[model samples]
Target: MRHAHKRCEDDGNWFVHPVTNKAWSNYTTCVDKDDLNFRHKINKLYISGYSVSVIALTISLAIFCYFRSLKCTRITIHKNLFISFIINNVLWIVWYTTVIRYPAVLFSNKPACQILHVLVHYFLLSNYMWMFCEGLYLHTLLVRAFVAEDKTMKWFYILGWGCPTVVIITYASVRSSYPEETILTPDSHQTRKAVRATLILIPLLGLHYIIIPFRPEPGSPEEVVYEPISAAAASFQGLCVSLLFCYFNGEVVALLKKKWNQVFTSWKN
Candidate 1:
């Protein structure tokens, strides 16, 4: 009998697993095998909306950052948030346009694949880390009632750009120790989900609830009036809670179900 799993010779085609011999299709390709016009339309709408929002946000941030006169200790946190938002927007565009649209390019060559993998993963992780930094800085200013006498621009560079760069370098070093192809299989997807939960999501949530609120000193009346840390804290808390639910209840549960199904199928066969 012919092998159940077969690898496609062409990178553009689907690949079959050696163990299960199951053919896996590339969903990233725009080719529509199924008739899902409504779904496709919705996706298009989402992409367009996201692109417009990103562009608007990027331009607004750029304008703000360009005006050095607007720089101040309090505004430094906003600047960091702007930088993070810009990077996140760029990453989103690249991810959707390149990885999602033309995934075959990812597996074209080892160097190309590695570069793409690093850029995609690094930017994505950095985006979240910078967001956490933004929250942390705001919390420090507001709740802890800490004020930096140093230049705001320098502080912005350190927290906004420096921290994310450090995180990216650290994550890249760890990932490079065990490099793999760009393909995202079901198993690899699960692993990525777990890693994100443990590394990014959990820590962020912890910072939002446990760390930021229970800092050295609660906000003074002046700090509360000027900084609005409580408002920011509430927003962070809501975001973290949403992410926790999505990962644990939604994504994790779905991945587990798929894994169990695969195991059951193998046993039956």
Candidate 2:
């Protein structure tokens, strides 16, 4: 495959590989192939990370939902957030196993494929919105500790779930107006601060390159050398949320201790 890009001499369009002198007629083939390979590697890592989060979130949800004593406004919010994580992670796994592995399916414009694409992104955005809800809930608790409002969760449900729909619908509407596969100009891509931040800072583990087989997309002018950084970050949701909201939870620890003591006492009897 590496030598498939060797110069044809009939057309000198492709930039020659310095070391191998490989230059194929359709340079974008190698680039797209590399892109596909990169996503494949990220899928493995996503599965591992997302699987851990699903386990943690499952435990967290079970503990909170099963125990009546753990019921509180904050815990309610946490449960909802964990639900979002569950959905987001599952959707991402579905995406990687199906769409990412078979990107041409996206080009097919199949109703199911298009719906899956929308759903994966919708839940992804919903996950972020739920995180915002967590932050907002925490802030509300701190700033308005005395102000007891029973309808707080109601409004939160609206903000967390409702707002993401508006944004996604607007996105779909705008995108539907445009042609398929519209590549962003260099300047446009540069202005994407969120994307830039994810690409630069999120993959701190530096594991993307290690997992991905070396398949350079040198022919692609728009493809970054480390594009997998953004993809990995985008796909690897829920793990941090699970760790923060469940594993390190003092309340959950106390509940576990209480339950353990109850079981031990029964056994002694």
Candidate 3:
């Protein structure tokens, strides 16, 4: 949904808030009663979705760790990706509960809140970078079957972790130079659908960018229909990835079934 701004007065001045008696940007259209109720529902949905994702990702990580026989370069990359997703999901949950819910914290410009903001985005970038590592590894494996896995993993590690650190550090440095008043805070009425739209969709379609051209205009009726779907997809992305890559993996399933059969046999004896 698009934010509605108050029209300028005839004298080319901003309108005054009746209650504050000060010149302020009127944004009432963006946060009406119905929108608040919708935001409440979306908040609950995000918590529930992220909680499920955390559980799923944690289980996947455990599976990867416990199965020594399943260990490989690919599983290593998967483990790192799972860790990134887990941290990102937790950060989002914390963001919703603390920073997002409390306008005072944002207005106060607390260092902790700003740090959390950086950390949340750091892990988000890590998630995508690790995914890139996965693709690169697979391509190298196919094209140059004799390539040394151990040697390449070092480079992958740098790409996945080091690159994001460099980028974020540069970003934070540049951002900090800007004046405090120039910093834009998130509006309560503005959902993060666009920012998170590609989270799970990437796994389903490696080219999630295809949908970018079709994005509905902000504040259009189409946006009302799109926001919930985008949010839900982004929130549950970790769960979807864990399910597709870990729980449903052929080797993992076979190993688990074999373990169950052995346990059943021992119990029978």
Better of 1 and 2 by lDDT: 2
Residue pairs in clash, model 3: none
| Residue 90 displacement (Å), model 3 | 0.7
- Runs off by more than 4 Å, candidate 1: 1-32, 35-46, 66-69, 149-156, 181-269
Ranking by TM-score: 3, 2, 1
Candidate 1 residue pairs in clash (backbone atoms < 3 Å): 5-21
* TM agreement with the true structure for every prediction: 0.48, 0.67, 0.78
Give the candidates in order of lDDT, highest first.
3, 2, 1
Q: Which whole-number lDDT from 0 to 100 does residue 169 have in model 2? A: 85
Best by TM-score: 3
Name the lDDT value of residue 118 in candidate 1.
65
Give the per-residue Cα lDDT of candidate 3 at 42.
76
Per-model C-alpha lDDT, please? 0.50, 0.65, 0.77
Judging by TM-score, tell me the better candidate of 2 and 3.
Answer: 3
For model 3, how does the per-residue alpha-carbon lDDT over 173-262 read when each residue is reduced to its tens digit? 876787374102333332242123234335552453455467788657887667676667778888888997888777899999998999
